[model samples]
Target: MSSQLLPRLAQEDESTDALSGPQTVTRQARPLRFITCGSVDDGKSTLIGRLLWDTKAVKEDQAATLRRDSTGQHNELGLPDFARLLDGLQAEREQGITIDVAYRYFATDRRSFIVADTPGHVQYTRNMATGASTADLAVLLVDARAGILEQTRRHATIAALMGIRQFVLAVNKIDLAHYDEAGFQAIAREFREIALSLGVRQITAIPVSALKGENIVLRGDDVMPWYSGPTLVETLEKATQRTGQSTGFRLPVQRVSRPGEGFRGYQGTVAGGSIKPGDSVVVLPSGVEANVKAIVTYDLVRNAAVSGDAITLVLDRPVDISRGDMIAAIDQRPQTGRAFTARLVALSPDGIVPGKRYWLKAGSRRQRVMVRPVSALDLATGNWDDAAVLALNGIGVVELDFEEDAIFDAYETNRETGAFILIDPDTLNTVAGGMIDSRRSRSGRFDALPDADRASITLPARLIEAFLKTEFARAHVGEIRVTRGEKE
Candidate 1:
């Protein structure tokens, strides 16, 4: 949104915790995954870095190095190494900005986190889409001084488009802006309106100073006195993790765990719901059915495993199951098809053109697809206009006609199974990210509108006659043409 320049700061001390044992109660539990996106220099990296440092998620040596390498010479005068915290790449280090999706891991007492620090620059929107696609929640940072900028709006709109409605709108850098109540409220109001317009109902705006380590992991006494809400860390811990509910159990069988050492089983994270031993399963896109003989983890045998658990499964009868086949519950089998329609954001500069071929990736399954552009919407203006091609950051609707069939649910029904991305076959770079709008049923109701009645009701009789005459002539059928001549 706002073009906030990178300011060189004097060096500062970044205190951190010593890495210890597993932080959460759930044994071998996976961390909550989230992506941060907003205007340039909105302090996304700094916020996350602070959270990790305060929560003892960072290793001691790494934290020490980060502190030593901070911007300025004196600890008090030095600027925090916020950008360097997540910009682990050499190129990013040299550029002093996040270039791609920099993934990092951290943990707290209540939960662990896989933070995808996405780039805020408008040019690198594709990277943002990749990071946000798998996120359970989107944390949007807004500079208190600048308020809601274009990039912030664009990121929020994209997150919503990608089926992410939960947002933590961090009004960051409040210290620099003097923690002005009016400034914080102004920015919050602006972003609230934008988030609401973009269909985000649950957004919590917190005034935070990521640089000063205020209201991030630990609540600060310096911010707005009127505000009384959970700090960023508290809020994140309280947020519910996303998982789809279905009677059907699905695991996009990754690879038959190479029958090594008397072990021939399917290895994959449960894509949706839970699966147990003795449950009837169906391998979809192939329509083969089998009963689960055993749900095996590496160490112990599990009667049931929930979604997100990576384990190998054994079936009673050997069936033709492969990498792409979706192993779902027999009774509640998900819809499987070769073609599907979706709302997509074209990530490339050349844009998405109709009848263009791209590699479609859903879960672990891949297919060559021909995208038929149904329509294109301008992200900045929300205008639905048709174009031969959709450019970078262009949001629109498209129908992906795939060469092979695969199982998928609606995004609203299940985000994990309902989302997908398009990749360039040549470059192998992702070109677009999409969400399947589940509201529309299989029937084509919108396309089957009573156009004749609508036209007659809306148009004048003279214009309707002219339209009918034009259509009849176009049809080239000899008929009783009741026109103005018959009336006369």
Candidate 2:
């Protein structure tokens, strides 16, 4: 959670010495990181197992265990208990539901993949969010019979909020629907409406039967000849990898190394932008400046290091730098302030309380901060409503007041430096995950608002007209007085 692969590394330069033969450099396609999430019994595990099984990512020994565990239980097609390959918990097998997030790594001729199979139950929504936080795309599964349910909407909304641009709609169990093309189209149409409401546009809907392995890695059978679209694996192989919010160079110092004689270096994974020797950098929070003298990795000098590289930087001058301090491009520094507003996902059972002090950790930096709920989202209306507390699995904006200077970029600008976690002092549990929105001044505006005047701010005609186009706005229909700043 401290570091993320935020950007793609540039191709390594091929160098040839005059005394040596030619050298060639080659690299495989970037691996895709995605998550599978939807309602329970939606066949997420089965789908992933089938993917791995068909790809031959599963070893013979593991497949043997699956066969033993599934001894007398085979589907009509004689497929093994594919879901058991992912549901490792005994309780999960007993209840036939996934409770924890399971991750699997696999590869094909085209590309490699890292997929997280997240729980679908409403209670484990936090688990789903955790899996989605770093995902480049989301594969939301649904039963052909059930269509789009509330839980489906919730997962889709969270994935979009977490900045996932690509979505794959796997309409599982098409066999149960008798491979009805009409039913498949109906579900895909409804899901598109929901996705559009959440501002997500890139979506691929495929009718599949995970249990039977149809349209997963192989083409559909004659029954579902109407589904001539690409298989799930084919879609994933061609899907794009995520390149997170771009920003100026940032390196949150994890350690300062003075390993040997006459050598000192700052160690950390580069979070944003690229760095090279001779570039001037600033040690944040202290304003001390230094010039990069070398970029070190595995004792070999690198010509340049970009985001996601784990390298040690040797500077021209010694500065008062330490753990938790950030080193950034001197010309494009991150924001430094004590107060900021952010959107947070409450992850604990106790939820987030107003006026509570929690340890806010962003990258290598951790500080005590007071959190106050400013306003929460009204899921029913998609409106920002005044809220005093943020409940479990709730996603809303809150105000963060740091005891000391807090350095971050707006989440829209740099995901690596802008994301943070809230830890409870008593239990040391991660209570919430947050993304920096925009900094706020040291103002009493939040605490000063009263219930009677909550929605008292008026808007211009153009603004009101803009609000009328939202999905929530249509549900209310002819019911508001914009001049008076109230809603019915």
Q: Estimate every model's Cα lDDT from 0 to 1.
A: 0.74, 0.83
lDDT of 2 at 144: 96
lDDT tens readout by residue for model 2, 1-488:
21333333221321101111122222245568999999989999999999999999999999999999998898888879998989999999998899999999998876788999999998888889889988988999999999887788778878987888778899999999989999999998888877777777667788999988898898886778776666888777656567764677899999999988799999999999999999999999999999999999986999899888999999998788899999999999999999999988888889997777899999999999888887886665556799988998787889888879999998767878988999999999999988898898885643433333334446776877898887666765654445643552
**What tens-digit string does per-residue lDDT give for candidate 1 at 128-230?**
9888877878989998888887788788888887777678888998888887888887877777777777776667778898877888887776556776766
Candidate 1, which segments miss by more than 4 Å at Cα?
1-30, 56-60, 71-79, 108-111, 218-223, 256-267, 296-302, 382-388, 438-488
lDDT of 1: 0.74
Question: How many clashes (backbone N, Cα, C below 3 Å) per candidate?
Answer: 10, 0
Candidate 2: Cα lDDT at 324: 98
